[model samples]
Target: MVLLDMNGTFLFGGDRFGPNQDYASTYRALGGSRLATDVVQTIIQTCFDTLEVIYNDPTRSDSFPQVVDTLRALPAARGVPPADLALLERVIAQHELGRVPDDYAVSLQKLARSHVLGVIANLLSRKDPWLQEFYRAGVLDLFAVTVFPRMVPASSHRGSSSTKQSVRWGSRAPM
Candidate 1:
């Protein structure tokens, strides 16, 4: 059984979330706010840090507010005002719940042929957001199990830990 990450590992975020592209869409999603290069870096760093906190502690609540609170305190916020945290969450949730690139589908199809696949996403938004993405991408049915924070609140799933003791473990049966 192999566990996969849902956000970046599986979803490319439609190309705005990779090398040298931290929080790319997020800048625009904040509503026409042009961040200075250094400020953008701070925002991106803070975003990742906030997300890690969520992943590290799934039981924690008010995650969106946490991100906002952290950013609001940053010196960068003075130059490039932080977007409305609620709106920020809404925008990210929208992307995660929307279309996945064709490459994701192709890769999933190949991997599913011989192995059990599961999605372990450490999301800031509610679990429904990711489910909406997987369903819209038509790859929701491919996974043996899709674990979200709501379902597996205690999982320390970063990668390949194979904590089979966790929730909803799947098995592959003989044909």
Candidate 2:
């Protein structure tokens, strides 16, 4: 069996927290036109800042709050309807998750013919968007197992080694 990380590996281009991010444009492109650009920008920055705090902490390496929850808690998001907040989460995910290229999908298919493929990804939001992308790329069924942070319960210790083992061995370990 082969294990792989999703971001920066098979998938690329998640730059939501990068310096060149333009949150407002992404928001508009994704049907978010009610909020002003500045407001969108502020909300995006706040999300980034909050995630950065958690990501930068060595002790919090394996823990993360859902991105949608983070967006909902922002002052800039005040009065934004739940539907809009959901859209905002997608906007943030758009910047954070890249696409699976046709070439990579082809490669994955080829690799899966000989080796069992599995995805071990750490995502701040739900895995639906990435799953949709995988389905779109026609590589969703290529994996023997897909594991994301939210799919596993929080452990007392850091890292996901035990969780990975449980999933790989077919243990009913809350995954």
TM-score of each: 0.47, 0.80
Candidate topping lDDT = 2
lDDT of 2 by residue, 35-94 (tens): 888888888888888977875776765555667777878888889888878878888788
Point out where model 2 deviates above 4 Å: 61-63, 150-175
Evaluated against the true structure, the overall lDDT of model 2 is 0.75
Candidate 1 lDDT, tens digit per residue, 120-175? 76454456666666777777777777665433323343433343122333344312
How far in Å is the alpha carbon of 151 misplaced in model 2?
Answer: 5.5
Let me know the TM-score candidate 1 reaches against the reference structure: 0.47
Give each model's clash number. Answer: 0, 0
Every candidate's lDDT:
0.55, 0.75
